[model samples]
Target: MKQLIILTLASLFFTASAAADEALTAEVLKEKSLAMCESKASVLPEGEKAEALAVCQCVAENTNYELILEAKKSGDDSVAKQHMEETLKTCKAEDASIGS
Candidate 1:
C-alpha cells in the first residue's frame, strides 16, 4: 500500500537524519577538544599553567559535553549562547580558577 511505502520512506529519512546528527556531534566534540587544548595551552603559566592545561585537556578528552559541541557545530547562535553559559558553570564548579 502507498501508506506502507510512505512509512518506510519516513523511517529511513529519520534514521539517516539521526546518523547525520551523530556524525556532526562527533565532529563538533573533536573541534571543541582541540580548541580547548589550544586555548589553555596559550594562556597557562609555564609550570602551573601546565596543570591547568592538563585539566582542560582532561575535560576535553574525558567528558561527553556533547550539547555544547552540537550547538557550536550547528551554528545555532541561541544554542551556542546557552551552551557557553552551561560550560562556564561547569568550569566554575569543576575548577574555580577556570572562571578567572
Candidate 2:
C-alpha cells in the first residue's frame, strides 16, 4: 500500500513519456528514469532518495534527455550514458539508486 501510494504520487507529478520531445519535460524525464531504476523497489513521497533524485534531476537537466530515452528504446543502453556519465559517477559516489 505504501509503495502504491508512492507510485501514485509519482504519477501525479508526471505522465509517461511519448516519443514527442515537447511532452518530455525535465520533471517528466526524472520520474520516468526513477520508475525504470526502481521498478522493483519502493520510493519516498518525493519519488526517491535525495541522492537518486539528484541524479535523475541532473540527468533530466541534460539537453540530450530525448537521446537517452531514444537509446533506451532502441536497446542501445550504452548511449544512455553519453550525456550522463558525470552525473552517474557523481551520484553513484553518493550511492544513488539510479546511479547504481
Candidate 3:
C-alpha cells in the first residue's frame, strides 16, 4: 500500500510538470518576448513605438524557441540567449525604421 501511494504521488508530480511544460508554448514565449521588448522600448520616444514593436515581432518570430526550451530544461541559456540577442540585432538592422 505504501508503495502504491508513492507511485501515485510520483505520477501526479510528473504529470503536473508535463502540463507546465505544455503551457509554455511558442505563443506564450512570443507574448513574453513582446512584453519585455515593450517595456524596454517604453523609454524611447513615442514616435518609435511602432518600429520597436516591429523589431520585437521580428525577434519573436525568428528566434529558435527549441533552443530556448532546451536551455530551460538543461539550465544553460548562455548560448541560446546569445542567439536571441543576435536575432534582436538582425531584426533591428532589417527594420531600418528607427534610429535615423
Candidate 4:
C-alpha cells in the first residue's frame, strides 16, 4: 500500500512537470518566431521600417508555431518562408488600400 502511494505521487509529479515543460516550449517557440520577424523587419528601408515591423508582427501573431517547430526539426525552411511571403503580401495590400 505504501509503495502504491509513492508511485502515485511520483506519477502525478512527472505529469505536472511534463505539462509545465510543454507550456514553456510553446512560450519559447513564440519568442523565437517574434525574433525571426524582428530580424527580417530590420532590413527594410528607414521610411518603410514601421510598416515592415507591423507586417512582421502580424506574421509572428498568425504563424503556426507547431509547424515552424516541425520545419526546424526537419531542417526545412519552406514553411517559414511561405509564412513571410504571405504576411508581406497582406501587408502590402493593406498599405495600398491606405494610399501608402
Poorest 10 consecutive residues of model 4 by lDDT? 1-10
Residues 1-100, candidate 1, lDDT per residue (tens digit)? 2222223223322332354466655555545554646654665456555545544544444444455445545755466445444543464355656545
Tens-place lDDT per residue, model 4, 26-67, is 456556556655665566567766665565555456555565
Worst 10 residues of 3 by lDDT: 1-10
Candidate 4: clashing pairs of residues: none
lDDT of each: 0.46, 0.47, 0.57, 0.51
The local distance difference test score of model 3 is: 0.57
Q: Give the alpha carbon lDDT tens digit for every residue of 34-67 in model 2.
A: 5644542334455544544454444344435556
Number of the top TM-score candidate: 3
Q: Return whichever of 1 and 4 wins on TM-score.
A: 4
Judged by lDDT against the true structure, how good is candidate 1?
A: 0.46
Off by over 4 Å in 1: 1-28, 31-43, 58-66, 69-75, 97-100
Candidate 3 stretches greater than 4 Å from native: 1-23, 35-44, 97-100
Q: Report how far residue 51 has shifted in candidate 4, in Å.
A: 1.7
> For residue 72, what is the lDDT in candidate 4?
46
